[model samples]
Target: MVKTARPRGRPPKDADPAPMEDVLQAALHSFATHGFNGVSVRTLNRELGVSHNLLHQRYGSKEGIWRTAVDWGFGQLTEKLSAADDESAPPLDRLRTFIRTFIHVSAEHPELLRLMNIEGGEPSDRLDYISERFIEPQMARFQQIWDELAKRGETKDVPQEVMYFMITSGGGAMFASRALTERLFTSRPLEPEHYAAYADQFTDLIMGALKD
Candidate 1:
């Protein structure tokens, strides 16, 4: 498949060139939609229309590219999550911030959850890599927020595991269920302004349920 060329406009001043950004995004979407076992460096190069030897030279193998793409994705998510708050707010407010931040990120990068869902279907090193490298650490931060909320009497007596899934999988499904969303809502990709509004509403809904 020939990748449709996107416009390459001039970047703003001091903008660091991320040459691999598009490649990693495409790789994530491919892995998400097609499954890890279904994709390869050869397929990536063929679809992406890059030099046949380029990905192999840079990444060494399909596994290497998969790891790098996954890392790039989670790294961006972690950065966005960290930028949402500085951890100085109240427990409840911090929880709200987390919810909003996640919702926005979900809208921006639905492929992330899709890829995880595919990998979660069966045991594999890919599953383990994402779990240990990304999911666990992020969940730890979520658990910290939950603990703080518990201390402040802001959260209910729900199991932390259930709450975690409710936010990550349940809430994210509203956005990440792209096939459904496109049919019911719009075919175009979600933009930041629209996601910001959705995040506000979604965050309020979660905070309402959590607050005593």
Candidate 2:
């Protein structure tokens, strides 16, 4: 069998991470504003005031810069989420806390969340990386909560997969729905007020479905 070419090394030893960060921030903004496929290297170069050669020399390719931006965004997000998980509350309470905090943060960081949603639709080589790095660990946390509920005979016939879907997807949809919700109602934000409503609705709906 023919050998595939391996990926290159990290940035040069003397290279500053700052310029790379600028490129990443610019790329992420473009991706979130337009989309992953909609962005071009020229567009990124214009945004960052960097030459095409600098971008390539530092990042290898546009795909490399995009991946770096996506990874950095997710890394920041995971830091906040893991911090939320570390709060000294019980499991279910902790889940709700995390959800509330997540929605609050999403409202504050729409571009970041938009980047994530956009990446979900793109042809990404980092799907497993994203999941394993962020989603799976959180899923395991939820699984522990679900296990406790099940032992108490408080759960339904629904599988843990469905429970995971309901919980996580509900939060995902809540954050994603803000744009549409903003169109219908004006003069009010979704984070504190409307987000609470959605969270309560989601919790009630999920609890009703899961509870025997």
Candidate 3:
């Protein structure tokens, strides 16, 4: 019989790791659910039922896994959020793009915010990694637009953080807390159209309030 081929670099004792993307997604969920300290590489291996050293072999440690996973999740949001950054677009139009895009993506990947919410409870190196890498950069871009609107008297002097809360806690709250929404709004359809409608409505309310 022809010899069977073995996957390269997957030593005798070490089984092949899942696709990196899938691994990161699962790791993100685990971190979101249990918090960083509550989970370990062994925990993930057990959860995946792979070789005990599989994650460690790939990630080197829990910190590495957390970084990889967090980056993977935020990378998706960052890409979609980029659609709002048309330099030729007017300031107000860009701002609307930013807000509505955020809502749509939040609806699509609530896990991104969920992971942040979990890490937000207490400050740690993990928190620093996320804040410095993802949170601060995204907020900085939005902050610049908000300042321009304030200068034009297009927006109130509402604290930037407060506006952020309005978006996250106000419009995105349903997706962020999926369990409650599923229970409360049994008839609601989670779809692209639904995301667009909510984003448009929320953006209108905020834009109107700013103009008022």
Candidate 4:
């Protein structure tokens, strides 16, 4: 009988940008479909169409991939927010722009939000990295905008955290309740009109909350 040799150690770290992105995309899909608990290296490798070595080489583990996926999602959000020409508009306009963009991006990339919710509960290194890098920067930018609006008397004197949650909750609800909405309402995917109605209501809610 032939004897098998001892197993080697872990593969080299993934350093290529393209393959890294591919793996990230697969992880995002897994998280969206099954939530955090549902993803695994075997499934990820299968979905990515890469070898187990390749997956491990790139992300180390499922947790690492989840972290990177969350970061990528937040990065996409930052890009969407930045691309809007209405950044200089009034606070309410800014809020509207963000809501519309948020819905558009979320509809396009539901996996990202699902991954975000999955990684949110774990106190892992990737979570800390995302919190420090992506979330903090975004919050600071929002706070500056809020301060500007406050000065202009467009916004009430509310704590920054409260404002952040209020804005985030709109997006969160749409994402979190998406399945429920789809099940109870029409089966057709969200259209511009659907998002528009939601955005309008969200904007009105924010305005009402801030009005003196």
Q: Could you say which candidate leads in TM-score?
A: 3
Report clash pairs, candidate 1.
none
Which stretches of candidate 4 lie above 4 Å from their native place?
Answer: 1-22, 32-38, 60-64, 85-88, 188-193
lDDT of 2 by residue, 116-143 (tens): 6665665566566667777788678767
**Candidate 1 residues 12-112, lDDT tens each?**
32243236888888888898889978887778876776767778777888888889999999888888888886688887877888888987888888888
Q: Distance (Å) between predicted and true CA of 135, model 4?
A: 1.4
Q: C-alpha displacement of 173 in model 4, angstroms?
A: 2.3
TM of each candidate vs. truth:
0.86, 0.67, 0.87, 0.71
Candidate 1: residue 64 Cα off by (Å): 0.4
Judge candidate 3 at residue 151 and give its lDDT.
Answer: 84
What candidate 1 gets wrong by more than 4 Å, as runs, is 1-18, 186-191
lDDT score for residue 104 of model 1: 85
Q: By descending TM-score, how would the candidates be arranged? A: 3, 1, 4, 2
Superposed model 2: Cα runs more than 4 Å off: 1-22, 112-116, 119-124, 154-169, 172-179, 190-212
For each candidate, the alpha-carbon lDDT, in order, equals 0.81, 0.65, 0.81, 0.67
Local accuracy of candidate 3 as per-residue lDDT tens digits, 180-201: 8778886384555688898888
lDDT of 3 at 116: 74
In every candidate, how many clashes are there?
A: 0, 0, 0, 0
Itemize residue pairs with steric clashes in candidate 3: none
TM-score of 2: 0.67
Per-residue error at 107 for model 2, in Å? 2.6
> Candidate 2: what lDDT?
0.65
Comparing 1 and 4 on lDDT, the stronger one: 1
Which pairs of residues have clashing backbones in candidate 4? none
